[model samples]
Target: MPASLSVETAAPLASAADRLRQIAASTVRPDLLGRIDAASRTLADATVRVVVVGQFKQGKSSLVNALVAADVCPVDDIVATAVPTEVRWGQQVSAALVTTLTEDARTIRTPIAPDQLRRLVTERSGAPGAIGTLHAEVTLPRAALAGGLVLVDTPGVGRGNARAATNLTLLPDADAIVMVSDATQELTDPELRFLQQAAALCGRVTFVLSKHDLQHQWRSIHDADREHLADADVDARIIPTSAFLHSVALRDQTPGSRERSGIDQLAAHLQGPVRADVVTQRQLAAAEEIVAVGRLLAMVAQSELDVLLDPASGGVVVHDLERAQKTAEQLTQRSARWQQTLADGVEELIADVDFDLRDRLRKVGREAERLIDSSDPGRSWEQIGAWLADSVTQAVSDNFVWAHERSLHLAGVVADHFSLDGRAALPELSLAGTDQALRAVGGLDFIGSGRLGIGKKLMIGLKGSYGGVLMFGLMTSLAGMALVNPLSLAAGLVVGTFAYRQDAQTRLDGRRAEAKAAVRRLIDEAIFQVGKEARDRSISSKRVLREHFVGVGESFKQSLAESVRLAKRGADMPKPERQLRVERLTADLAELRALCEQAASFSTAHASVALRSAS
Candidate 1:
């Protein structure tokens, strides 16, 4: 069965979402409506992302091809995947290249030949000045992808530091991850750390031991991997697989071949349990949101009923209304404590970030000086320059990531201070554009030595020799000796050598100063660029939270006013009219209560069905 059973299940989910929106609109609860709309899209699309990740040459691409039952991902031993490739369902095989260079660029669906896919996705294929592709998207008709299952083949880890960082970035967005490892070795330290992180970011993870046919001790490796995972307190399933065996079995039509390959079992697990769980989780989330909105509606209706039925309740209700209105007014004021806290916190954060950046650059400067002093700058300037550039870039990237994370943490703290509901959603904090800023800062230039020219060195040496000869010859002449004496000759040689050494030391000091100045310039540029971005993000967060709370305050005030108005109107009516009005209100509340019950029941029933299917 398709994971979501879209045809059978989508209608009810959509209907419930729409009904919630309608209720929200009628009640003037735009916040509730927005939440429903977001949940509705998740239920409608039902995308389950299963990312395939592993070390270099572990047959990750081949495994992806086999799982999808199509050769969508390019597999090569020489050059690994430089960009991620996503495989999804389509009526025909098609491909497109996605680049992160421009926002307005359209993705032209081009017909890519099977042989050319490797070229398009690999970094070695791009022209000297051409833009690199971020990732590739390929779609083909496959039963495994029928239920909106998207399989992403990511770049191999351990290939490069940047590649590993990119892979880590992908984890937060993955619904499930399939980590591939070779049977030849137990999990490496980096791979184990990755698994631990994946377990944290994504709730569902599976380990695949690939190339089982290549190793005779595949089972031992698998058992060792399981033990390692258990020691790390990460619960995950480890399945041994051989792409070669699976392909040969299919081609030869051998009996029990599919079972031996383990591809069939893997496919069954993905298409059945994994798919069902994703769908059920989304369904439950949407159902719960609907129930929350329903409860809000019920609460409002009951308040009105209470006000209309009890004569003495009017004074109490009016007093509560006045108090709520005051609270709402305070939320919009500049003097609000949460607003003040946010402003002060952001200011302090900016100062701290600036100080930290300067301190890092100072350390880099000290290290660069030591390196320059240890060797002749002219002899090893190129290597030292390259090392400095790489180190600076890494430092800048790390700082930017830290700033991004801190900004998010600060936003949460601000939200808490405002007493925002736990379920309130915030926009995704993205530092995607920071890479461009880093690039703009460019690499460090080689700070050449300020040593004197050969002519100047000779002049300085000559001057020192003349001074020594003059002084020694005068002293020797007083002792009744000639001006051109052995004592003057020896003294001239010693003085000239000392002068040359001193000149060289001065040049070295100048070069070190220049290098330190260059490093400082780079750090300053990074701070200007990255710090600007951080400040903008913090300000934007503050604005968003302010507006969200303001909306909440307004909604509360409106609800309270509506209750008070109904109460006042009912009290002014004649006895018979008041009774009729009460009866109508009662009926309306009953209808709303029933709808709320139905929404909850629908959610419960679907959850049970999903659980049964998963089992």
Candidate 2:
């Protein structure tokens, strides 16, 4: 952060929480802000919302029924409980089943018995092609709520029933999904997508491979389940349970059999503050990221403002603001390329999977999954650095060219209108240089590579051709916004500012750090003119241009140092696709400069505001 843009001096740990508090007080973007606030508060309150998820008959309701020691959810042989029967501890004094709808709402306070529930909440269409469309909210006893953590029993997803189909919709709300994988069948793609989605929506998601005791050998199944968790990027705190084993214990109502069965143990673990803590953690993590960004932005802005006030500070502010704008432009452009990178990765993965490696013989009995998986799985850290550099290089180069061509004409128009070379230079003159520069940067930066990763995670391997063109097209809408008008470019960049949020658990820690750094970069760009930005300007320039230009050069140097640091960091990630993308970004940056120079050369004076951006 530049000296001019400096703001927050507080320690990092508590800052995010404070930022949230501040945001709560303000009404700006309250809807969006409130989501973060809710997430933050939920995290702080330490509440957990656990959902007992599985196929309809796979004992979902029965598990909740057994765990909560209540029959709140309608459970029967017909597999009814279709539209996500959420049995939670409601604020209402009495037990009630509230079904909120688009048009109206209804509540059933009477304890809904299994048989009666079947009649009231029958199957309906248009719900993932499931049987019912009613939202069932049941109230559980206080003990069951367990510190405000609600246990939702959703209709099993893989059962091909309408209930299971709706599982995707409800998965995001769950902190932990007890995936009661039928000890009988293999986990399907939908199940996998559910886990993937859960991981995306809620950072902390775990799975349960129920009916463990039903199998002859539990070790192999457990191992496979663990591996499955790894592939889906899910964290496994798996416990195998068999209601059948406990049936004997519960049948006689004997406490000993129940504890030995593990069902009681699993249920005990599920209904605790620990589960709520998981949900809270996810919310906190999101809040922390956003606050961190806001902090950096505020700090960077202060640094710029400081430079703006001190003429002695010279052009530092202008330099930094340009850099910040340029960097932002690059990020989005890199995001745009990620789709192709992912596609190429898929091709590479498929290629590798097709290979007949003989090394497996040295390590015998290796399964097909273990054999073909890439050594890097998803590109290694080293690969990431290389990828970024390549993308940046390419992006910079292209944008630079575009800028150079257009800048000459712009320079002629501005005609040194605000010449830095003279005392008569009108500081009041509003040159569009900064604004145009922002446009150049934002324009290319908006070409994001995010599509590929999103598709891989969300579309799964189920999507067919058309590039799933429709899905990609929706994302392309950002491009349209970037192209709208002058101010719209920056606004688009701000509004379209997206975090590449994914549920890849291991990568999450790293991804989070990257997001923070990205925010910092943006702030740095926004306040381009900083006293500290003159690191690159030849100190000897003092002889030629005096105070302002020299100071501008210094500020440019500071900004360059920061860019170099980012580039150096990018060196650690060496994936071919990322490397290619970074090169692309670099290219864009070069082109960006060329265009800016062109505009400068044409304008007899500074445009004052040059923005280069791609949304």
Candidate 3:
């Protein structure tokens, strides 16, 4: 179904290390391969087989059917061949086709046509302009047993719609590729671009310019396509002929065409022994993927096993379960600033309003009754108190709306400038911070909501002694029924406004500090992981590459020494020495003769082995 599943259960017919072992077994050049793989494996996936791809009208289905002598992919639709498809084999067994992708698949079914395929691709993949999917097996006793030479028929590269692009990204897992451009139009820009880029994946490439029957008279078209490929240094076959034309003409009636069955010859070449080595290497690589995946699974978390097996950043470790407690603590500490900033913003609202509601209310209460001097002083005061209460209520309602609006305006202003990393996001924080700000201005009501009594509210919220802080709101009320002369409500308003400003400023500062600390902690952890991984991968890649090179060097040394020894001649010999005057000369001659032959063979095998291993 998924590639992840393929990797997990594959049992990697070979491990990464086993790929080396397999190479040692499969090498045609034992001297070179043994040197290459003895110390460690490298290049296990040695072949790059390419699937010739394009739109329905682009001759993809035709080309593949012709090559394999079987109709492998469906070719009957004008508009809908979009879903991703796969075709795997099980030797010459002729097992049924199995189509799969994210649980939408058909098993034991024949291939589907392009129009039918459109439904599968669009409805299932959620990709635009999708065609139905097809995944069939072409198992002939002769086919699967052909090592690993698989030539797939893919949807168009650039011609397919967006839906096509999403599903068809997987077609080029080939040892080499042969891009088929229609011979009539020749090498169009779209066709040329796809070929140029696909070549990077596998250097082995050939260009097939099909549709030659219509353009046979136009020899210039064939010459042009050939020249383009050659100029790009693309060592690919540029064949200009139609599969249908070739197939039909080869029938008994077309005498001269009988000699040239284009499709038949292409199949024979692809099925030859030349492909054996490439197929073996691909098999080895597939085996290696299976083994490596298995080894890592035992250690991953059961819930996260799929993620670890996933191909994209699969090995990345985010938060481990063990870190939950510490991470929670960090989050809790971090959120305090959010609450604090809002409260600070509320204080700012109160300060910037200019008219403190409490003080203004107090002035209204006193001014309305300041004209009263009663014959019954106490009773007169009672009458004045009733009138003042009404006056204060009316004045507070009317005047305070402006103050409230000012507060709302200031909150929005500050919030608009907030950022998460630089400053808090003002719009969101201002919205979220509203409740905290209201509690700050709500006098006794605000204190009760926070699990703090009026006394504690004064202490924590006012940041002052209980008596002085508690007197601010309560004093305004007392001044309206004064035992003394009227109080300075404006002065009190100014003082209270300052307190609100200070609180807003303090909260903003705290929030900024908290957010910065969070970023710093995250960055520090990332840096540590990067450093550890850098050191580890560096050591691993180097160890793997070095041992491989050393083994190659040792093999080279042995080869060179062996060559020297073989060059030595038994037919020729050095002159013999005499005695007396030649006594000294005779002694030297004996020593020289003894070493000459040995020098030619001295540890040459071991030397070559050492040279390859080191090199």
Return the TM-score for each candidate structure.
0.71, 0.41, 0.36
Looking at model 1, which ten-residue stretch has the lowest summed lDDT? 125-134
Return whichever of 1 and 2 wins on lDDT.
Answer: 1
lDDT of 2 by residue, 155-216 (tens): 65433232243444454455666667756555665566556555554455546666666677
Preferred candidate (lDDT higher): 2 or 3 = 2
Put down candidate 1 lDDT per residue, 368-388, tens digits, no spaces.
Answer: 778877876666777776666
Error of 1 at 553 (Å): 4.2
lDDT of 3 by residue, 1-615 (tens): 112322332232323334433432432335534433422332343233546654346676677656655555566546434443334344433433343332233334655443444344323334332123334344444453254456665555442132233212342245556576665676765555555555644455656666666665546887887787777666666555467755676444574563343555555455442254344433334333222222211112121322223323222322232243233233224243433444465455444332354455446534532333212222243343344433432333233334334443544543332221121111111101011111122211010111226674354444432333345546655756432223434444454556655664565444434333432342233223322322332333333333332333333333323222211211121223112313432343343333322222223433454466458
- Model 2 residue runs over 4 Å out of place are 1-16, 19-39, 45-47, 91-116, 122-133, 158-163, 182-237, 244-253, 268-287, 290-297, 304-311, 314-615
Top-scoring candidate (lDDT): 1
Poorest 10 consecutive residues by lDDT, candidate 2? 423-432
Residue ranges of candidate 3 with Cα displaced over 4 Å = 1-49, 84-148, 166-168, 249-261, 272-615
lDDT scores of the candidates, listed in order = 0.70, 0.43, 0.40
